[model samples]
Target: MTTQTKVSICLPTCNRPDLIVECIESCLAQTHTNIEILIGDDSKDDRTQRMIATRYQHEPRIRYVRNTPSLGQARNVSSLFNRASGGRILLIHDDDYLAVDGVERLVSLWQRHPDLDVAFANQYEVDQAGHVDREASDRLNADFYRTKSAEGLQQPPGRTGLIQMFPNNGWMANADLVRRISYKEQYGMCCDYVFGVELCLAAKQVYYLNEYVSFYRKTDVSISMTTKRSTSAASVSAYAFIEKLRLDRPLEPARKLALRRIVPIVVSVYSRNHDPIKGLRIAAKNLFAYNYGFSMRLYYHLMMISRSMLTLKPR
Candidate 1:
């Protein structure tokens, strides 16, 4: 069937020139031919630019733009959104790619349901050396997306609710949605969480496909997993931003009640890669003092107990 819905895959990349070629190649191989692959490169190195231009230069659909000065991660992603031309924009990270026929499936479902404001399916987690990990799917721990329809609304405009939409930051939404909201600069690590909340709150309908469409390569080098002393500040800032967003919105009594149930889980997420005591300290100093209420207090007290129990559990 002929379709007019154009999809733009915006890939924002940096230093990894070697991995990017495969990433672009995967997009080029999509069965859905109506795709414009926009590459926003932040690398100052001419070699990376030369490599992208040389390999995909012949492909008319490929548009490569190199930033004169690196805009860093979050802004570069936001920049790519501004430059995107397709009706649908997929904010693909540098190290990720669509599975074969992945774009086709997304396009097909989107075409079938034009009313959906957003759509995201499952994605695979590949290892650093590029070996596909069959087990990463298990870690997701829920059929949250599969059971849901292609279009619907998400509730509670904050981190807890946003994670349910696209767990790995892989999905396609209307380009207009991208323009409607900008990533919260304050939350460096969790900007997507804030953005997702904004999108879900605005969207009348959202979609979730059970099938896995993209491969998220998990490596020590990837930004999210890496822990350094310098990044702790940024991580703490993200948590504070999330706390503020959660508290700012006027929510119903029931949803707020549900949020109370989930605070300890949120605390543990922040502590997984860092010291538990330090993460709790950040939570207490920032979220507790500024945003504490029914849920925050419940979470703080629960986190204290959970942290101790966690220490006792065998790894």
Candidate 2:
């Protein structure tokens, strides 16, 4: 690729007029000039569109699209990719903003390592007040740092590392590759995880840059935070997708072990949405089939009991 390779920051927004400006400004502030900020606005009101029109209308690198009646979240985000004209794509949420030179650093890394199919970096989770929650951020990303090699490069822990630490908003990839493995519209909450796994499995080489790429705002209103109440169909679909990968892919022993460790977490979520009986049945099937560790089996057993107790009706 040439030095002038364009990078598209595909941001999908809906009723986030308060935060969308900062996101757009961050994309505009990138040191790399060869970039475009594609905003697919799904806001019910005209606030976001008006703001963009009034403030960023003259900016040549920003392309704004307003949905007539709102396309919801998944389709709205997927549409941004359809309109993107860059060689590389970074799908960022409207509430999340880059670290000023984040795009420049990512582009530079890709330029140095031209063979990389996808590149991701660590992120700082900030609050609604824009304060970095260092404690929470560190806790969330501790695994990646712990697994870092002596060469400063973080190796995938196992075959399923990509699925486990799929950078939801802190990653960039070749536009062509992303387009080929597009996000599934049916997946409501776990689309990014599913897409991330697909990219990792298909990629020739996935790189992890040490730089902090973006600030992911952890607000109560975010999809992840809101979806914790009930197990979303999307979450169930994502778990099933991973299970299919485990069965179909000729994974190494380490990878299968890593996957086994992740199954209980999915089962817990499934239990919260459905019932403990269903969760236990699925858990038992996997535990017996995979011959999971004693600790994992114990954890699942406890989870089933806890869920059952929680669902008990008042006499």
Candidate 3:
């Protein structure tokens, strides 16, 4: 790639006009001059389009697309990739903003490793008011394997991504790799992770730059925030996709046990979503994964019964 390689910042938004403004500004503030910002507004109303028109109308670097009838979370993301004109694409969620030199640093890393298929870095988590949560950020980084000790190319990208979720904010990837990939509608809320895994496997060249390159806004509506209800089926389906994937022989067991070892908190949620028969079957299937003794299994059934009864009753 040339020193002046172009980058497309794909910012996908919905009705959150208030949040997206900072995202656009952050893209505009990138130190890399050869770039374009593509905003696919999936908002049901014209609020987002109006905001861009008024605030960034004169900005030639931005190309805004108001998706008709709203393309939904997964498709909206894919649409931005479809329109990207740069040799590389960096995706910045509407609710998140880049660190001023995010693009410059990631671009520099890619330039250094010209064959890099995907590259991503750490982020600082901030609340609605933009106050950084120092503790939560540290936990998140540790949870995702974003250790302060290591940075640079990953030897086996898929394994690193499965454990660390490298498709997160502050990511930049070859336009060709991303263009060949799409956020499958079937993946639903977990489409991004699924997409990232696909890129990791196909590319065979991925990098992890362990530096904070962006701010992840922790808004109430952001999916990271727990909701009043659980979408167990969606979560199950995405996990199924992961389970079915064929990776290098050594990585398969680690991949299967990855979610099991980490997401034990979801046991009750999964139980509540299924009928008693299915719930018990699930419990039996992953008894070892849960690592819960007989007492825990009994407790799971009781909780499932209570929640199931509650949901069956009319409001």
Which candidate number has the best lDDT?
3
- Order of the predicted models by lDDT, top scorer first: 3, 2, 1
Top candidate on TM-score is 3
Worst 10 residues of 2 by lDDT: 150-159
Single out the weakest 10-residue window by summed lDDT for candidate 3: 225-234
Off by over 4 Å in 1: 141-161, 228-235, 246-315
Global Cα RMSD, each model = 6.6, 3.6, 3.1
Candidate 3 C-alpha lDDT tens digits along 27-50: 988777789999998888998888
Which runs of model 2 end up more than 4 angstroms from their true locations?
Answer: 1-3, 144-147, 150-161, 246-262, 288-315
Provide the global lDDT of candidate 2 against the true structure. 0.73
Q: Estimate each model's TM-score.
A: 0.75, 0.85, 0.89
| Per-residue lDDT over 1-315 for candidate 1, one digit per residue giving the tens place of the 0 to 100 score | 514778888888888897888888888898878888888888878877998777777889888888888887778788888888888888777788788787777767665667767767777778766777766664552433333343333333232244444554668788998778857665676677667767766765666677778887876776656643333433444445445554444643423333333344455555654456654665455443334745655465556646655775466
Better of 1 and 3 by TM-score: 3
Task: Please write out the lDDT profile of model 2 over residues 252-284, one tens digit for every residue.
Answer: 553455456555666676566646766776677
Two-way lDDT contest, 1 vs 3, winner: 3
Q: Could you arrange the candidates by TM-score from highest to lowest?
A: 3, 2, 1
Candidate 3 CA-lDDT value = 0.76
